[model samples]
Target: MKRREAREKAVQTLFQLDRTEMSIDEAITYIIESPIDPFYERLVKGTVNHKEEIDKTLEDKLEHWSLERLPKIERTVLRLAVYELLFEDEIPHSVVLNEAVELCKRFGDEKSGRFVNGVLSKFEQK
Candidate 1:
Protein backbone atom coordinates (compact mmCIF):
# COMPACT_ATOMS: atom_id res chain seq x y z
CA MET A 1 0.00 0.00 0.00
CA LYS A 2 1.05 3.58 -0.59
CA ARG A 3 2.42 5.62 2.29
CA ARG A 4 -0.60 7.90 2.21
CA GLU A 5 -2.97 4.95 2.40
CA ALA A 6 -0.90 3.41 5.13
CA ARG A 7 -0.95 6.64 7.13
CA GLU A 8 -4.72 6.93 6.88
CA LYS A 9 -5.10 3.32 7.96
CA ALA A 10 -2.60 3.81 10.76
CA VAL A 11 -4.58 6.77 12.02
CA GLN A 12 -7.74 4.70 11.89
CA THR A 13 -6.10 1.75 13.61
CA LEU A 14 -4.59 3.99 16.25
CA PHE A 15 -7.95 5.64 16.70
CA GLN A 16 -9.52 2.22 17.26
CA LEU A 17 -6.84 1.20 19.72
CA ASP A 18 -7.26 4.45 21.59
CA ARG A 19 -11.02 4.09 21.96
CA THR A 20 -11.17 0.40 22.72
CA GLU A 21 -9.38 -2.53 24.34
CA MET A 22 -8.33 -3.98 21.01
CA SER A 23 -4.78 -5.22 20.57
CA ILE A 24 -2.55 -3.87 17.81
CA ASP A 25 -3.06 -6.98 15.71
CA GLU A 26 -6.82 -6.76 16.11
CA ALA A 27 -6.81 -3.11 15.18
CA ILE A 28 -4.64 -3.78 12.12
CA THR A 29 -6.85 -6.62 10.93
CA TYR A 30 -9.98 -4.57 11.48
CA ILE A 31 -8.70 -1.77 9.28
CA ILE A 32 -6.58 -3.61 6.71
CA GLU A 33 -8.05 -6.73 5.14
CA SER A 34 -5.15 -7.82 2.92
CA PRO A 35 -1.74 -8.93 4.10
CA ILE A 36 -0.36 -6.44 6.62
CA ASP A 37 1.61 -3.66 5.02
CA PRO A 38 4.92 -2.88 6.74
CA PHE A 39 4.48 0.88 6.75
CA TYR A 40 1.02 0.71 8.25
CA GLU A 41 2.12 -1.77 10.87
CA ARG A 42 5.14 0.36 11.61
CA LEU A 43 3.03 3.44 12.18
CA VAL A 44 0.67 1.65 14.52
CA LYS A 45 3.30 -0.39 16.30
CA GLY A 46 5.78 2.44 16.59
CA THR A 47 3.13 4.77 17.90
CA VAL A 48 1.98 2.25 20.46
CA ASN A 49 5.49 1.35 21.43
CA HIS A 50 6.46 4.92 22.07
CA LYS A 51 3.13 6.35 23.10
CA GLU A 52 4.33 7.68 26.43
CA GLU A 53 7.07 9.68 24.81
CA ILE A 54 4.74 10.81 22.05
CA ASP A 55 2.12 11.86 24.58
CA LYS A 56 4.71 13.70 26.61
CA THR A 57 5.82 15.54 23.51
CA LEU A 58 2.21 16.35 22.71
CA GLU A 59 1.57 17.41 26.27
CA ASP A 60 4.37 19.91 26.03
CA LYS A 61 3.08 21.29 22.73
CA LEU A 62 -0.58 21.59 23.56
CA GLU A 63 -1.49 25.16 24.41
CA HIS A 64 -4.40 25.14 26.86
CA TRP A 65 -5.89 21.73 26.17
CA SER A 66 -4.41 18.62 27.70
CA LEU A 67 -3.59 15.64 25.53
CA GLU A 68 -6.53 13.65 26.89
CA ARG A 69 -8.85 16.57 26.32
CA LEU A 70 -8.17 16.76 22.60
CA PRO A 71 -10.53 14.94 20.27
CA LYS A 72 -9.72 11.29 19.78
CA ILE A 73 -9.05 11.66 16.06
CA GLU A 74 -6.73 14.59 16.60
CA ARG A 75 -4.94 12.82 19.42
CA THR A 76 -4.40 9.68 17.33
CA VAL A 77 -3.28 11.68 14.29
CA LEU A 78 -0.80 13.58 16.40
CA ARG A 79 0.57 10.38 17.85
CA LEU A 80 1.02 8.78 14.44
CA ALA A 81 2.60 11.89 12.96
CA VAL A 82 4.84 12.38 15.99
CA TYR A 83 5.94 8.78 15.63
CA GLU A 84 7.01 9.49 12.07
CA LEU A 85 8.53 12.82 12.97
CA LEU A 86 10.55 11.46 15.87
CA PHE A 87 11.51 8.00 14.62
CA GLU A 88 10.87 7.57 10.92
CA ASP A 89 13.74 9.59 9.47
CA GLU A 90 13.16 8.08 6.04
CA ILE A 91 10.16 10.38 5.52
CA PRO A 92 10.61 14.12 5.25
CA HIS A 93 9.18 16.36 7.98
CA SER A 94 7.10 18.28 5.43
CA VAL A 95 5.53 15.10 4.08
CA VAL A 96 4.70 13.88 7.55
CA LEU A 97 3.11 17.20 8.49
CA ASN A 98 1.17 17.48 5.23
CA GLU A 99 -0.07 13.93 5.44
CA ALA A 100 -1.09 14.51 9.07
CA VAL A 101 -3.15 17.54 8.09
CA GLU A 102 -4.78 15.58 5.29
CA LEU A 103 -5.56 12.75 7.66
CA CYS A 104 -7.20 15.20 10.04
CA LYS A 105 -9.19 16.78 7.23
CA ARG A 106 -10.34 13.38 5.99
CA PHE A 107 -11.14 11.69 9.28
CA GLY A 108 -11.70 14.51 11.73
CA ASP A 109 -13.79 17.64 12.03
CA GLU A 110 -13.39 20.84 10.00
CA LYS A 111 -11.03 22.36 12.56
CA SER A 112 -9.01 19.22 13.04
CA GLY A 113 -6.65 19.99 10.20
CA ARG A 114 -5.84 23.44 11.47
CA PHE A 115 -5.39 22.19 15.01
CA VAL A 116 -3.04 19.45 13.86
CA ASN A 117 -0.97 21.85 11.75
CA GLY A 118 -0.66 24.32 14.58
CA VAL A 119 0.55 21.68 17.03
CA LEU A 120 2.87 19.94 14.59
CA SER A 121 4.39 23.14 13.28
CA LYS A 122 5.91 23.58 16.72
CA PHE A 123 7.77 20.32 16.22
CA GLU A 124 8.82 21.39 12.73
CA GLN A 125 10.19 24.64 14.09
CA LYS A 126 12.20 22.91 16.78
Candidate 2:
Protein backbone atom coordinates (compact mmCIF):
# COMPACT_ATOMS: atom_id res chain seq x y z
CA MET A 1 0.00 0.00 0.00
CA LYS A 2 1.42 3.33 -1.01
CA ARG A 3 1.22 6.39 1.21
CA ARG A 4 -1.46 8.08 -0.91
CA GLU A 5 -3.69 5.04 -0.72
CA ALA A 6 -3.30 4.99 3.02
CA ARG A 7 -4.08 8.67 3.08
CA GLU A 8 -7.28 8.05 1.16
CA LYS A 9 -8.36 5.54 3.75
CA ALA A 10 -7.41 7.85 6.55
CA VAL A 11 -9.49 10.61 4.99
CA GLN A 12 -12.49 8.31 4.81
CA THR A 13 -11.94 7.20 8.37
CA LEU A 14 -11.89 10.78 9.55
CA PHE A 15 -15.01 11.58 7.58
CA GLN A 16 -16.79 8.58 9.08
CA LEU A 17 -15.87 9.60 12.59
CA ASP A 18 -18.14 12.60 12.28
CA ARG A 19 -21.18 10.39 11.77
CA THR A 20 -20.41 7.25 13.78
CA GLU A 21 -18.50 8.59 16.78
CA MET A 22 -16.87 5.17 16.98
CA SER A 23 -14.14 4.38 19.45
CA ILE A 24 -10.59 4.40 18.14
CA ASP A 25 -10.42 0.65 18.56
CA GLU A 26 -13.61 0.17 16.59
CA ALA A 27 -12.42 2.57 13.94
CA ILE A 28 -9.10 0.80 13.69
CA THR A 29 -10.82 -2.54 13.37
CA TYR A 30 -13.13 -1.24 10.69
CA ILE A 31 -10.30 0.30 8.69
CA ILE A 32 -8.06 -2.75 9.00
CA GLU A 33 -10.80 -5.16 8.07
CA SER A 34 -11.94 -3.02 5.17
CA PRO A 35 -10.08 -2.80 1.87
CA ILE A 36 -7.93 0.08 3.10
CA ASP A 37 -4.28 -0.95 3.07
CA PRO A 38 -2.27 -1.74 6.18
CA PHE A 39 0.22 1.03 5.45
CA TYR A 40 -2.45 3.62 6.34
CA GLU A 41 -3.26 1.97 9.62
CA ARG A 42 -0.53 3.92 11.34
CA LEU A 43 -1.95 7.14 9.94
CA VAL A 44 -5.41 6.24 11.19
CA LYS A 45 -4.07 5.50 14.65
CA GLY A 46 -2.03 8.66 14.73
CA THR A 47 -4.88 10.87 13.51
CA VAL A 48 -7.39 9.51 16.00
CA ASN A 49 -4.99 9.86 18.90
CA HIS A 50 -4.21 13.46 18.13
CA LYS A 51 -7.30 14.76 16.35
CA GLU A 52 -7.92 17.66 18.66
CA GLU A 53 -4.42 18.96 18.34
CA ILE A 54 -4.44 18.37 14.61
CA ASP A 55 -7.73 20.13 14.13
CA LYS A 56 -6.58 23.01 16.29
CA THR A 57 -3.42 23.35 14.30
CA LEU A 58 -5.42 23.40 11.10
CA GLU A 59 -7.79 26.00 12.42
CA ASP A 60 -4.84 28.09 13.54
CA LYS A 61 -3.12 27.90 10.20
CA LEU A 62 -6.24 28.49 8.14
CA GLU A 63 -6.88 31.98 9.39
CA HIS A 64 -9.54 32.84 6.81
CA TRP A 65 -11.13 29.42 6.64
CA SER A 66 -13.01 27.82 9.43
CA LEU A 67 -12.55 24.07 9.83
CA GLU A 68 -16.31 23.59 9.77
CA ARG A 69 -16.70 25.45 6.51
CA LEU A 70 -14.54 23.08 4.52
CA PRO A 71 -15.96 19.91 3.00
CA LYS A 72 -15.54 16.81 5.10
CA ILE A 73 -13.27 15.09 2.60
CA GLU A 74 -11.12 18.15 2.18
CA ARG A 75 -10.91 18.64 5.92
CA THR A 76 -9.93 15.03 6.47
CA VAL A 77 -7.25 15.16 3.79
CA LEU A 78 -5.88 18.36 5.23
CA ARG A 79 -5.92 16.87 8.69
CA LEU A 80 -3.97 13.85 7.55
CA ALA A 81 -1.39 15.96 5.74
CA VAL A 82 -1.07 18.40 8.60
CA TYR A 83 -0.61 15.55 11.03
CA GLU A 84 2.19 14.10 8.95
CA LEU A 85 3.91 17.44 8.57
CA LEU A 86 3.70 18.30 12.24
CA PHE A 87 4.28 14.87 13.75
CA GLU A 88 5.88 12.56 11.21
CA ASP A 89 9.42 13.84 10.93
CA GLU A 90 10.54 10.77 8.99
CA ILE A 91 8.45 11.96 6.03
CA PRO A 92 9.66 15.15 4.44
CA HIS A 93 7.34 18.14 4.41
CA SER A 94 7.43 18.20 0.61
CA VAL A 95 6.25 14.60 0.47
CA VAL A 96 3.36 15.36 2.76
CA LEU A 97 2.47 18.44 0.74
CA ASN A 98 2.65 16.70 -2.60
CA GLU A 99 0.68 13.70 -1.48
CA ALA A 100 -1.93 16.00 0.01
CA VAL A 101 -2.24 17.78 -3.31
CA GLU A 102 -2.74 14.46 -5.04
CA LEU A 103 -5.43 13.50 -2.57
CA CYS A 104 -7.19 16.80 -3.12
CA LYS A 105 -7.14 16.26 -6.84
CA ARG A 106 -8.68 12.83 -6.50
CA PHE A 107 -11.16 13.37 -3.65
CA GLY A 108 -11.90 17.06 -3.56
CA ASP A 109 -13.65 19.64 -5.69
CA GLU A 110 -11.96 21.52 -8.53
CA LYS A 111 -10.29 24.02 -6.24
CA SER A 112 -9.46 21.56 -3.51
CA GLY A 113 -5.96 20.73 -4.61
CA ARG A 114 -4.95 24.36 -4.70
CA PHE A 115 -6.71 25.11 -1.45
CA VAL A 116 -4.91 22.27 0.25
CA ASN A 117 -1.61 23.39 -1.19
CA GLY A 118 -2.09 26.92 0.09
CA VAL A 119 -3.08 25.82 3.57
CA LEU A 120 -0.15 23.43 3.87
CA SER A 121 2.24 26.04 2.56
CA LYS A 122 1.13 28.29 5.38
CA PHE A 123 1.73 25.41 7.77
CA GLU A 124 5.22 24.88 6.42
CA GLN A 125 6.09 28.54 6.76
CA LYS A 126 5.63 28.31 10.47
Candidate 3:
Protein backbone atom coordinates (compact mmCIF):
# COMPACT_ATOMS: atom_id res chain seq x y z
CA MET A 1 0.00 0.00 0.00
CA LYS A 2 1.11 3.56 -0.57
CA ARG A 3 2.27 5.34 2.55
CA ARG A 4 -0.64 7.75 2.31
CA GLU A 5 -3.13 4.91 2.16
CA ALA A 6 -1.32 3.25 5.04
CA ARG A 7 -1.59 6.46 7.01
CA GLU A 8 -5.29 6.64 6.30
CA LYS A 9 -5.77 3.09 7.40
CA ALA A 10 -3.74 3.74 10.49
CA VAL A 11 -5.91 6.71 11.35
CA GLN A 12 -9.10 4.71 10.88
CA THR A 13 -7.77 1.84 12.93
CA LEU A 14 -6.56 4.18 15.62
CA PHE A 15 -9.87 5.99 15.65
CA GLN A 16 -11.68 2.71 16.14
CA LEU A 17 -9.33 1.69 18.91
CA ASP A 18 -9.84 4.98 20.64
CA ARG A 19 -13.63 4.70 20.61
CA THR A 20 -13.75 1.08 21.60
CA GLU A 21 -11.91 -1.22 23.96
CA MET A 22 -10.58 -3.43 21.18
CA SER A 23 -7.02 -4.69 21.06
CA ILE A 24 -4.77 -3.38 18.31
CA ASP A 25 -4.90 -6.60 16.33
CA GLU A 26 -8.63 -6.77 16.71
CA ALA A 27 -9.05 -3.20 15.64
CA ILE A 28 -6.97 -3.73 12.51
CA THR A 29 -8.90 -6.83 11.59
CA TYR A 30 -12.19 -5.15 12.20
CA ILE A 31 -11.48 -2.15 10.02
CA ILE A 32 -9.31 -3.48 7.22
CA GLU A 33 -11.08 -5.30 4.43
CA SER A 34 -8.02 -6.32 2.47
CA PRO A 35 -4.70 -7.90 3.32
CA ILE A 36 -2.64 -5.79 5.69
CA ASP A 37 0.66 -4.21 4.71
CA PRO A 38 3.69 -3.98 6.97
CA PHE A 39 3.58 -0.19 6.97
CA TYR A 40 -0.03 -0.21 8.02
CA GLU A 41 0.70 -2.62 10.84
CA ARG A 42 3.71 -0.65 11.90
CA LEU A 43 1.86 2.66 12.12
CA VAL A 44 -0.96 1.25 14.20
CA LYS A 45 1.28 -0.73 16.52
CA GLY A 46 3.92 1.97 16.88
CA THR A 47 1.41 4.70 17.56
CA VAL A 48 -0.36 2.55 20.11
CA ASN A 49 2.84 1.32 21.73
CA HIS A 50 4.07 4.83 22.32
CA LYS A 51 0.65 6.38 22.91
CA GLU A 52 1.22 7.45 26.51
CA GLU A 53 4.40 9.32 25.66
CA ILE A 54 2.84 10.69 22.46
CA ASP A 55 -0.18 11.92 24.36
CA LYS A 56 2.07 13.62 26.90
CA THR A 57 3.97 15.35 24.10
CA LEU A 58 0.69 16.39 22.43
CA GLU A 59 -0.78 17.65 25.69
CA ASP A 60 2.30 19.80 26.19
CA LYS A 61 1.94 21.32 22.73
CA LEU A 62 -1.82 21.90 22.70
CA GLU A 63 -2.67 25.55 23.45
CA HIS A 64 -5.70 25.26 25.71
CA TRP A 65 -7.19 22.03 24.43
CA SER A 66 -6.79 18.79 26.23
CA LEU A 67 -6.22 15.80 23.98
CA GLU A 68 -9.56 14.36 25.04
CA ARG A 69 -11.43 17.52 24.13
CA LEU A 70 -10.28 17.36 20.52
CA PRO A 71 -12.51 15.65 17.99
CA LYS A 72 -11.74 11.99 17.37
CA ILE A 73 -10.63 12.54 13.78
CA GLU A 74 -8.25 15.34 14.73
CA ARG A 75 -6.88 13.41 17.66
CA THR A 76 -6.34 10.33 15.48
CA VAL A 77 -4.62 12.38 12.79
CA LEU A 78 -2.36 13.98 15.34
CA ARG A 79 -1.50 10.65 16.94
CA LEU A 80 -0.50 9.16 13.59
CA ALA A 81 1.53 12.20 12.55
CA VAL A 82 3.21 12.47 15.92
CA TYR A 83 4.13 8.80 15.70
CA GLU A 84 5.76 9.29 12.32
CA LEU A 85 7.53 12.47 13.42
CA LEU A 86 8.95 10.94 16.57
CA PHE A 87 9.59 7.31 15.58
CA GLU A 88 9.70 6.77 11.83
CA ASP A 89 12.98 8.33 10.81
CA GLU A 90 12.77 6.98 7.26
CA ILE A 91 9.97 9.45 6.39
CA PRO A 92 10.70 13.16 6.06
CA HIS A 93 9.09 15.48 8.59
CA SER A 94 7.58 17.71 5.92
CA VAL A 95 5.95 14.74 4.27
CA VAL A 96 4.54 13.66 7.60
CA LEU A 97 3.21 17.15 8.26
CA ASN A 98 1.63 17.43 4.84
CA GLU A 99 0.00 14.04 5.03
CA ALA A 100 -1.38 14.87 8.47
CA VAL A 101 -2.86 18.08 7.21
CA GLU A 102 -4.40 16.22 4.31
CA LEU A 103 -5.87 13.64 6.61
CA CYS A 104 -7.36 16.35 8.78
CA LYS A 105 -8.84 18.08 5.77
CA ARG A 106 -10.30 14.84 4.55
CA PHE A 107 -11.66 13.55 7.83
CA GLY A 108 -11.83 16.32 10.40
CA ASP A 109 -13.76 19.58 10.80
CA GLU A 110 -13.18 22.67 8.66
CA LYS A 111 -10.54 24.05 11.02
CA SER A 112 -8.93 20.70 11.71
CA GLY A 113 -6.29 20.94 9.00
CA ARG A 114 -4.95 24.20 10.40
CA PHE A 115 -5.31 22.99 13.95
CA VAL A 116 -3.32 19.89 13.14
CA ASN A 117 -0.70 21.92 11.31
CA GLY A 118 -0.28 24.29 14.25
CA VAL A 119 -0.05 21.53 16.82
CA LEU A 120 2.38 19.48 14.76
CA SER A 121 4.62 22.50 14.20
CA LYS A 122 5.25 22.60 17.92
CA PHE A 123 6.24 18.94 17.90
CA GLU A 124 8.68 19.55 15.06
CA GLN A 125 10.50 22.07 17.25
CA LYS A 126 11.35 19.41 19.81
Q: By TM-score, who's the top model here?
A: 1
Worst 10-residue lDDT window for candidate 1 reads: 117-126
Worst 10 residues of 3 by lDDT: 117-126
User: Each candidate's TM vs. the true structure?
Assistant: 0.95, 0.85, 0.93
* Candidate 1, residue 46: how far the Cα is off, in Å: 0.4
Error of 3 at 56 (Å): 0.4
Residue by residue across 1-126, what tens digits does model 2's lDDT show? 777767877777777776576976677667657664656777887887788999898988886789989888788888888888877888888888889888888888669988888889986532
Worst 10 residues of 2 by lDDT: 30-39
Q: What is candidate 1's lDDT per residue for 3-118, written digit by digit as tens?
A: 99999889888988996889989888989997889988888999999999999998999999998799899999999999999999888888988999999989987699999999
Candidate no. 2 TM-score: 0.85
Which lDDT value does model 3 have at 61? 93
Better candidate by lDDT, 2 or 3: 3
Candidate 3: tens digits of C-alpha lDDT, residues 1-126? 898888988998999999688999899998786678999999999999999999998999999999989988999999999999999988888888899999987788669999999998876533
RMSD of each: 1.3, 2.4, 1.5
Candidate order by decreasing TM-score? 1, 3, 2
What TM-score does structure 3 among the candidates reach? 0.93
The clash count for each model shown is 0, 0, 0
